[model samples]
Target: MSRYVLERVQLSAQNHPKRHAAVSCAIGGLLVAATSALSVIQRSETVSWPAVIAVAVIGGGAWAAAMAVFVVRLQRRMKPLPPETDPARVRAARRLMRNGELGPDPETNALAVRMAEQLQSIPRWKKFTTTAFLCTTILGVLVTAPAISDGEVGKSVFYGACTLFPLLMLTVGRARLDRHHRNAAEIRRAAEHRTNTEAER
Candidate 1:
């Protein structure tokens, strides 16, 4: 069980991806708080301030953790980079050699060109860093919502983010991820074509 809990948090393509980052960060934050609470099961010092602190610690820590994860990942994901390498290089190279011409790509430049092309199509960081920011912000509100005297703040925060943030990220990421994936598929095709072309040459 303990192993399972940790396993869920380990970094993966799913966890690292921008679209999932917000939820992962939010859950991670909450998980931290939950872990702190487990200390009580072992101790006989139940029914005291310690219990309160433990719960508070867990919840608060989770909230903080969620915030950090989203911000960092968002920043990194958004950075600009060169294009991906297309497999077409070797074949293209052979073709160029046979024709006694050099243009567009040298062996070294092929990979760079691929990466440059990819970078041109991806989204920026500010566009996707909603991970901790949205998730923790939501968790923070939900954590505080019950304390609202007349449910005023609860309603305000809940509708504001639960609906707003997710909707915004979903709408944007839906398109962005789609494009990113499409570009990746294109790159893969380019690679295959490159390889096949090289073989033919």
Candidate 2:
């Protein structure tokens, strides 16, 4: 659990490819929640800000939870490493300068690229779904509050707009994350090939 959480954080990147996007998503959620709380506290009027803030909190939490679940599921799908792994495999994968007869293995790299792309795409749906869940939870809580009345039609409009925002955010964030991964994979492959040829000769 702890290890998976760590990996999640690494993938949620601000700038680098190595930062866990899962952990990043979780942290982003907490921050959104915190911002919502602050917005609620700072407001002078009994405006619909409370509902908005509550919704934001819920969305953020949902994003984090969805990502954490993804990390757990992905780990289960991965096969454990070998006890006597090939030395060439280690050198080819880990040491950029030590590549011998091996370059990037096409079968594994292609499989990985496909897997990563699938992960990147599927998780966007998870993100949006979680976001929708979060907003629903917040809206439910707010609706029951003494302040919010079902009688007011305008509040429904407010809820709809606020609820949709997180999914939008998730869509944009996921797109950027996938783009970076593709670029990183290409660079890694290129470096591996160059080193493999240098070592071969």
Model 2: residues >4 Å from true position, as ranges? 1-69, 77-161
Per-candidate clashes come to 16, 10
lDDT of each: 0.50, 0.50
Task: Quote model 1's TM-score.
Answer: 0.34
The digit string of per-residue lDDT tens for model 2 on 48-158 reads 766866777787788777776665555444342332434344333432212212235754443334333333343346556666767765764564342345454554454
The TM-score, computed over Cα atoms with residue i paired to residue i, of candidate 2 is 0.32
- For candidate 2, give the lDDT: 0.50
Compute the lDDT of residue 24 as modeled in candidate 1.
57
Model 1: residues with Cα > 4 Å off, grouped in runs? 1-56, 60-159
